[model samples]
Target: MEKYTPLRTATLKPKSIYYPLHIRKLIKHKKKLFKEFKNSNFGLDEYIKVSKTIKHLINSYKSQKIKSIVSNTNRIYKYMKNISQKYSPIPCLENDNIFIFDDKTKCNLFASVFARSFSNLPTFDPPELTPCKFMHALDDIEFNLLDIDNILKNLPNNNCCAEDGISYTLLKACHSSITPFLSDIFRLSLDTGIIPQSRKVSYITPVFKKGDKNNAENYRPISITSTICRVLERIILNSLLIHLEENNIISQNQFGFLKKRSTTTQLIFTFSHWYKAVLESKNIDCAYIDLKHAFDSVPVRFLLYKLFNIGIRGKLLNWISSFLTDRTAKVKINNTFSNSFQIHSGVPKDPYWDPSYF
Candidate 1:
C-alpha cells in the first residue's frame, strides 16, 4: 500500500484547496489590471468605473454587525416595555411643594438670597481689593439706603412718596410703583403701600485690614457674597408674597414674618425655616420663568412701565434707559484693556453689585 500524505503536504491538493488558489489568482489579475491602468493614461470615465467596482466589492465584504446590534436593541426594548406595563408605577397627581417643576424637570424661576455672616469666609483677593476698597465697603453697607433715596427722588407726582426712614420710604415708593401693575394683573387693590421690614435688622461691621498670618487674630475675613444674595432674595420673596396675597392665593392669616439675620449662615438657616413653613402651610405651585435673556431682552417700553410702577420717573427712567441702550463689557489685566459684547440673556453666576443692570 502507498503511503498517503495530508492534503496540505501534497504537491497537488483537492478542488477545495484549488478553489482558494483560483480566488487569489483572480484577485492578483485584478490588481495587475489596476496597475496597468494607473501606468497608462486612462480617461476619467474608466478611472471612475474601476473605483466604483473596488468600492462595491469592499462594501459587499464588510460585516453587517451594526445592523444586527440595532435589531437586537429593538427586540430588547419591546420586551422591556411589556414587562414595564405589568409592573407600572401609580401616577402621582399631587406635586412636590418643595421643588418647582416646569414642562421639563427644572423650574423656570427661583429666588436667591445673599448674606455672608461669618468672619471666616474667604476674603476678596488682592486684585479685587486694588480698587477703592474703602468705597466698595461703604457702598455695600449703604446699598439699601441708596436705592431708597433714588426711588424717592424719582417718584412721580401722581405716585405716593417716601416719608422719613430709608426703608420706610422705599417700601412706600415701591408699593406705589408696584401696586398699579399688580392691580392690572389681579384686577384688585394689590398694593399694600408698605414695605416689609428688613430681615437683616443689624449689620456686622466689616473688617478692612489684610491681616498678617503670624497674628492669627488679625487675619482678614472672607467676603460673603451670600449676604448680598440673601438680601436680594428677601426682596424678591416679599414682592412675590405681596402679589400672591393681592391675587387671593393667600390670606392675611396665612402671612408670616421672617426676621433678617446679618450672617450668611443665619440668612440661609432662616430662609430654610421660612421655606419649610410655606411648604407645610400651602399647596404652592412655584414656577420659575427664566427668560432667555432677562436684562438684554427686557423691552424698553415694558421695562419703563415696570419702572414707572415702581415709582421711577423722569430723568431716572431716562438715565436707566440710556444706560442699557449702548451696552459694553470689558476685563482689564495689568494696564491693557479689551472690550467685549455683552449678552442680552442668561443669569450671571456671580452676583454683581447691580445685577438688574446686566
Candidate 2:
C-alpha cells in the first residue's frame, strides 16, 4: 500500500489562497500607477479607483470563502487568527496612587487586582447537601486510550505555548505516540488524587477590558495551562458528565454546558414560552442580572462541597479539589514575565474559539 500510494506535499503560496489572478493584476497596476505619477491627480485618481475595486473584490471573495469554509477547522482557525485583535503593548499602569512602569510590576499589579476580587465569603447560605445514592458505584475516575485519543484529536491546533512550553499543535502531532503514556499518567493521577505541579502552573495573560488602560482593574486574567493537563481535564469532564446524565442530576431547564444546547436554544425556548403566554393574554416579566466577576469570585471550598453533595465523592472529588488548590500563575504581558503567585480561588478561564468564554 505504501508503494502504490502517491505522496502529495503542500506548498506555501506567496499571495493569499483566496486571491485571484485579476485581483493580482489590479494590485500590480495600482502600484505601477502610484509610482509613475506620484504628483499627478489623474494617475492618483485611477490608482484610488483600482484600489477600491480591489478592496471590494477581496472582501466579497473572503466573505464567500468564509461561508464555504465555516465547517473546515483549519481554514476557520486561519481566518480567526487573521481577524483577531492585534496585541497592543500595555503602557504604565496606575495602582493605589502610584504609576507602575516596569512590565513585571505591571503584571504583579494586575495579578494582585485579580486575586483580591476572589472572595471566600459566600453570597448566600447554600443548603447542606447529602450524598446522592447512585444505581452503580462511581468511586473513582479513569481514562482509557480511546478517551485520550478522542480528546487530543479535538484539541485546537493553535501554536500558543502554555507554561509547560507545549503547544496544542505539537501535542496533536504526538497524540498517537503519547496516548498510552498519557492514559497511564491520567489513571495514576486520578487514583492518587494528586496532580503534577508542572500541570498546575499557568501563564495568566492580562487582557485589556473597556476602560482606562492604565488602571489594573480594567484588565482580566486569561489563564493558559499545560496542554497535557487540559487533556486530562477533558477525560475527567467526560466521566463526570456521564455520571451526571445517567443519574439525571442536571435539570432539563438548565441549557448551559449540555450537548446540542446553547444560548440560541435557550432563547428559542424562552421566546416560545413568552409567545404562548401572549396568545393566552398573559403578561410576561423578565429580569436579566449579570454577575460581576462570576468565575473569579466563586469560592473554591463551597464549589468542592457542592460537587461532593452531587455524588462526586471519593477519589474523583479529591482529585478535583487538588486540581483547584495549590495552583500558581504568572502574569504574561508581552515579553515580560511576572513572579509566580498562588491562585487562591476560581476556575481557570482559558480562551476558546467558541463564545463560551469571553
Candidate 3:
C-alpha cells in the first residue's frame, strides 16, 4: 500500500459551483444600492460614497476584462509566431531575369517594383475629382475635444503597434499625458499644413496573394503604422465623410466603407437589382472590374488632383498631399529584417483612411 502511494480521484466542477452565495448576495445588494443612489437626491457625503462604490465596481469589472484581453492577445501572438515560422523569405525576382534571396536585395526589388507601378507624372497636376463648386466650406467644419475622447475610446487596446512600440494599452495608461500632445498635433496639422512625421512611416508586411511564390508581384503589401497616426487619420476621415455626406457626393452604387455599409450590403443590393431586372424581362448586362492591387496602383498626384476638384482646397488639400508624400516602410520576417525603403505609391491601408482616400 505504501509503494502504491494511494491517490484520491478528483471531480471537475463548474465555475459557478465555486462562487460563494454570500458574496453573490453582497454583490447583488451593492448593485441595488448603486441604482438607488443614482435615482435619489442624496446628500454630498452619500453621493461621494456611492460614486466611489460605483467606480470601484466598474474598475473590478474592467480589471477582469483586461486579464482576459491580455491572455487572448498573448495566445494570438504565439499563434501568429508559430504560423509565421512556416513561411520565411525566399528567393524572389531581382529583375525579370534574375532571382535573389538576400533581405536587402529582396527589399530593394519590392520597393522599386511598387515605386515604378505607382509613380506620379513629373508634374503634380490637380486631381480630376475636384468639384465644380463648393458644397461646404472646409474651414466651417468644427472639431470638438470630445471627438478626441471618442476616438480614443474606439481604439482597440490590442492591435498592431508601430515602430514606436506604443500599444493602445500603453496609450490608454498614459492618456492624460498623451491626449494633450495628440490634440496639439491634430490642431497643428490643421493649422500649419504639415502632417506629423509618424503618419508618413509604415511597417510593411508582404502577405502572399494568389500567384507564383517566387514572383514579387504575387504579394500584396499591407501597412501597419502608429496607432496615434491612425487616430489622426480617423479624425480626418470623419471630416471627409461628413463633407461627402453633406454634399451627397458618394454614389448609390458604391457601398464600401460608409457607416453601416459593407460588401455584403452591395452584394444584396446587386442581387435585388438584377432579380428585378429579370422579373421585368429587361435585357441587361453587368461588368465586374477587379484591379489587382487597385489601392496601391493609384498615382498620388492624380488622386490629389481629384481631391482638389472635390472641394478639399487650401491647407486641407495641401495637408492631404503632404500626408501622401515621402512615405517609407521596412519589411519584417521572423528575425530577418529588410532595410527601410521609400514607398512612392499605394495609399497606406488604415481601415478608416483607405476607402475615404479612394
The TM-score leader among the candidates is 2
lDDT of 1 by residue, 172-252 (tens): 457546544433422211122122223112211122234432221232222211222233333333443344344444322
Clash pairs detected, candidate 2: none
lDDT of each: 0.34, 0.77, 0.69
User: Cα deviation in Å at residue 350, candidate 3?
Assistant: 0.7
Candidate 3: C-alpha RMSD after superposition = 16.0
- Model 1 stretches with alpha carbons more than 4 Å out: 1-301, 333-335, 339-358
TM-score of each: 0.21, 0.77, 0.66
Q: What is the C-alpha RMSD of each candidate to the true structure, in Å?
A: 32.1, 7.6, 16.0
lDDT computed for candidate 2: 0.77
Clashing pairs in 3: 126-305, 127-305, 127-306, 128-306, 129-306, 130-309, 130-310, 131-309, 131-310
Clashes of 3: 9
The window of 10 residues in a row where model 1 has the poorest summed lDDT is: 107-116
